[model samples]
Structures are given as structure tokens and as C-alpha cells.
Target: MSTDTNAIGLHTSTATQLAEHLNILLANYQTFYMNARGYHWNVKGNQFFELHVKFEETYTDLLTKVDEIAERILTLGHEPMHAYSDYARVATIKEDTHVSDGTTCVKGLLAGYKSLIELQREILSVASDADDEGTASLVGDYIREQEKTVWMLSAYLG
Candidate 1:
């Protein structure tokens, strides 16, 4: 590997790739957060109180992760993609619409979490290769938390 480094001491080429992946992760998190917000607002059923609070918590965590991911991109000396337009262009997770059912909302959350895990795993691999421990640890933490979330959500659905 070339010793050439960016402002942060990472290889410039690897940082660029990591930034691109992180941007995709950011976009997905934005869409997921919005979906969670919608679920929190629109959920109706016997489980209303429980699900409403859970959705709020989920979105709150996602919003924090979105900011952290953006900051990591900046720390890599690359601009994070911020606009919704750019997110729409780059994100794999599509916007969920008019989904007011608790079951449906949980399903959407599952899908979103699955997508995030896959992308984060990719980021983890690249960060490992590039020796970017900060980014690697960040995504690793996200992956672990989300995996537990997926399990809990799955249990809720069942």
C-alpha cells in the first residue's frame, strides 16, 4: 500500500471510496429516520403507545447516526452529501409512504436495518483495508447496535 495520505493521514484513494460509501449510508439513514417519524406520527392500533415510543426512539438514534456519519466523512477530508436530492440519487433505501400500520412499519424498519447492515459491512471491510480504525470502529458500533435492534424488532413482529 502507498504511504501517500490525505490531510487525516489516510490514503487519499481509500478515503474517497470510504466517503462514497458513508454518503450512501447517510442517505439511507435519512430516509429511514423519516420513515420512523412517519410511523411515530401515524401508527394506530392496540400497540399504539408502545410502537409510537419505539419509533420515536428509533428515529432519534438514526438521526444521531446520520450526523456522526457525516462528521466522519468530513474528518476524512471529504464533503458529506447533504441534500435530499443527492440522497435520493445515491441511496438504495427508498422512501416509505402512507404506511400507518404497526406491522407494516416494523416491516419497513426491518428492511431499512437490513440495508444498513449490508452497507455498513462493506464500509467495515474497506475501512479495515485502509487501516481507518476510526471509521471501522464507528461502523462496527452501528452494526452491533442495529443487529440487536433487528432481533428485538423481529421479536416484536412475532
Candidate 2:
């Protein structure tokens, strides 16, 4: 693939790389969504109501993001990975097997959010290098959201 000399034009290779990164992001989003849903359903103790509602909101937003990320990958001319098997292979976030307390769940979510933010940072760097302004913008927005979520979850643990 040839590199575009124009600062505003994306190179073909960059576009392909962005697509791959988006696919991984999509998978992670699914994993996070499912985990959030699990926490929403199984969360117990005095903070159940608040944490349940928050987890529902987080999972719903992540569901929307999953679609958006997949669409973005399509826009970049790559097929989005859509199966559980595919997600399991690509996602950096792993599912929890046991239901834990609200505090434990919050801690777990914070760790996952941090991992996701790191992955997004790497993808953003590649997007910037490729001159894929659209992808870079998307990653930037996503990083902010993830960072906020991380902060909120961490605060819950304190």
C-alpha cells in the first residue's frame, strides 16, 4: 500500500491497521458490555440499587459503542469480527466466572477500563501516524469516556 503525501489523506496501510484495531476494540466492547450486564444482575449488598443502575447504563452505552465501532471498521473497508469465538480471540478483557461484591466488581471494572484505555492509546497512535483523522478522533473520544468510567468505578471502591 502506498502512503499518502497529503497530511489529510490516509494511507491504505493505515486504514487497514485502523480497521484491525477497531475490530479488537469492538470485541473488547462486547466483553465489557457482557461483564457489566453480569454485574448489574448479580450485584448485591447495600449499594445494589445504585450500582445496578450504573452498570445498566454502562452496558447500554457499551452496546451502542459496539455497533459504532463495527460500523467504523466497515467504513474502513474491513470486516468486523462478530462471533463469540471471534471476540474471545481478540478481546483483551476477560470475563469473570464468579459473582463478587459490588466493591470487587468496581475494582475489576476499573482494571478493565485501564486496559482498554491503554489499547485505545496504542490505536490512536497508529491512527495518527496513518493520517486517519476520523479514526483518531473516534479513539480520542472513546479514551475520554473510558477514562471517566475508570475514575468513577475507582471512586466507588474508595
Candidate 1 lDDT, tens digit per residue, 1-158? 45678888898989999999999999999988998999999999988998999999999999999999999999998999989999898889999989888899999999999999999999999999999999999999999999999999899888
List candidate 2 segments past 4 Å from native: 1-9
Off by over 4 Å in 1: 1-3
Worst 10 residues of 1 by lDDT: 1-10
Residue-level lDDT of model 2, residues 40-106, one tens digit each, is 8899999898889888888888888888888888778778998999999989999965775988778
Cα deviation at 3, candidate 1, in Å, is: 8.7
lDDT of 1: 0.93
Q: Estimate each model's TM-score.
A: 0.96, 0.90
Error of 2 at 61 (Å): 0.8
Best by TM-score: 1
Residue 77, model 2: Cα distance from true site in angstroms? 0.7
- Candidate 2 positional error at 27, Å: 1.1
Candidate 2: deviation at residue 104, Å? Answer: 1.3
